[model samples]
Target: MLKEFREFISRGNVIDLAVGIIIGAAFTGIVNSLVNDVLMPPLGFIMGGIDFSSYFINLSGGDYASLKAAQDAGATTINYGLFVNAVIKFFIVSVSVFILVKQVNRLHRREQAKPSAPPAQEVLLREIRDLLRDGAPPRVIPAADSRTV
Candidate 1:
């Protein structure tokens, strides 16, 4: 069982999967930061400084200045601002992955489009066959000349 486990762990596919998982985790962090820090700020600024992070629907019949304040006051609230941020993050990740897959597919198609050379033996045989077909004439060994050699 241990040997089988070792073999499974040593496989190239397993290593590639591990590396991909680590990279994906790091990429998620970057996309989250981009959505929350970079994109949202400018978007909020353009929309009359309306901070989306504080936009929430109070369900407890009391007005609160911010989401935190509402939560602190034990108010039931629908945190739509956080939901908006999540949606933006999902969109960015989706577009990025789509573009990446598209480029990878393009590269794969280019590789498939390239013509590969034939094997050396096949090429040599083709050349010899062509020579026999078009470049050579049949040698006529006259019956009378056969005895002279």
Candidate 2:
């Protein structure tokens, strides 16, 4: 059982998957920051300076200035702005992953496009075959006159 576990941990695929998961977690943090801090601000400004982070409807009878205020006052609210932000984040991450995969595929295709070297033995055999095919025909001597006069 211990040996099996060790083998599983030692496998290249498992190690690669672990590394990928760690990198993906880090990438997610960056994408989330980009969405929340950088992208959303400009997007909100372009939409008539409306702050998307605060765009929500208070379910309770009383009105609140922001989602936090509504939540603090124990009011049920539909946080549509947060949902929109999440959707935008999803699109950003999806597009980035798509581009990365496309580039990797392009690189893979380029690697495959290179021609392989021919085998030395095969090359030599082909040369010999070509020589035989293009060689002059053999002349036949007469049966009675063996020597050339």
Off by over 4 Å in 2: 118-125, 136-149
Question: Against the hidden reference, what TM-scores do the models get?
Answer: 0.77, 0.78
Q: List the residue pairs that clash in candidate 2.
A: none
lDDT of 1 by residue, 42-117 (tens): 9999998977878899999998888999999999999999899889989998999999999999999999999999
> On residues 27-141, what C-alpha lDDT tens digit does candidate 2 reach at each position?
9999999998899889889988877879898878897877898999999889999899889989998999999999999999999999888899999989878877989464566
Error of 2 at 61 (Å): 3.2
Task: Predict model 1's lDDT versus the native.
Answer: 0.92
**Least accurate 10 contiguous residues by lDDT in model 2:** 136-145
- Name the lDDT value of residue 136 in candidate 1: 87
